[model samples]
Target: MKIQLASSEADIERCYPIVARWREIEKRSQFVRQIQEQQKFGYYFVYLEDDRIEAIAGFHIIQTLARGRVLYLDDWIGETSEYTSGYSRILFDWLMDYAREHSCQSLRLNSSVRNIQAHQFYFKNKMKIEAFQFSISV
Candidate 1:
């Protein structure tokens, strides 16, 4: 297995399968380009095994009064059936390791309140319900 920040257009192409589960694939290349080039805020990382992308994480570092320096996990997805598997845990552990290496005070991600399964997974990973998130489309 190999894990690294996804850098090339080809890398983004390879990421399509895992990410397409949540978003439209036709728009993916453009989105990946924006994240890799236009945004100064984040990086997209991919986990590959036997040359196939099995997971992807999009994260950024941010400083806020409440959290100090933190790792903001904007997106994460793996093989749908692998959600509760050891592979998912491996990916998550990797993300946490990244936070520690970067000196981030906290690592956070917002899951939709309706995602009960994901909530359970978060709880299983020892994360607490610290705050509720609210959002509105602009």
Candidate 2:
């Protein structure tokens, strides 16, 4: 599999169906134009194998009061059939290498509470749950 920057409409289309499912659950277009606009300063990667999209991962380089300069992973989704098939690891490993090359302090992500399997994957991958994310809707 190869990781490539998803800049074209076709690339985004490849991710739309899978990401739309997540957007329905989350009640927002997590990777819409606003987020894509932010990609100008960061990275938006899609995994491809045999001319088909396997997964998508987006990250942004940002400075936060707590984490400072870090690569914040905004979203990741793999085909259900490909889940736990090592594609996720490959994508993450590529992101890690990318981060290292750019001198990022850390990689951060916010996983929704509903995504239990994803949490387990993160744990298995040696990622720690550093904090609980709380939110209030106005």
Candidate 3:
């Protein structure tokens, strides 16, 4: 098992299918292009076993008046059925380790209010609900 940042185009492209499964990306090209643009401040991390990608995490470091320097996770998905298994733990642990290594004050991610399962997982991981995020679609 290995976790790595998808820095090369080939590695990033290899993550497209898994990402598309959980995201509404319309095309692989669009995914690549958008990833490229975001790479200026963010990163895509892939979890691999036997060279097959099993999970992906997209994150960026940010400084906020409330949180200070935070490792903000933007996207996360793993094999649909197996996401609740240890594989997710490995990936999540990796992300946490990374945050500590970078001297981040916290690691955070937002799950939709309707995603009870994800919320449960976050709770299981010992993450607290710090605030309510209110948004209106424009």
Error of 1 at 120 (Å): 1.3
* Model 1: per-residue Cα lDDT over 1-138, one tens digit each: 777777777776677777778876567767677667734555656564435677778888888998899988888887755667566788888889988999999889998889888888889999888998887999
| Every model: Cα RMSD to truth | 1.9, 3.4, 1.6
lDDT of 3 by residue, 6-111 (tens): 8887888888988898899999989988888889756655545545778888899988998899999998888765447677888889999999999999999888
Q: Per-prediction TM-score, please?
A: 0.87, 0.80, 0.91
Which has the better lDDT: candidate 1, or candidate 2?
1
TM-score-sorted candidate list, best first: 3, 1, 2
Model 3 quality (TM-score): 0.91
For 9-85, candidate 2 gives per-residue lDDT tens digits of 55665666667765663423554554466666666655554456677787778877887778888878886644587
Model 1 clashing-pair count: 0
- Which prediction has the highest TM-score against the true structure? 3
CA displacement after TM-score superposition, residue 24 of candidate 3 (Å): 1.2
Backbone clashes in model 1, listed as residue pairs: none
Cand. 3 Cα-lDDT: 0.83
Candidate 3, RMSD to the unseen true structure: 1.6
Model 1 global lDDT (CA atoms, 0 to 1):
0.77
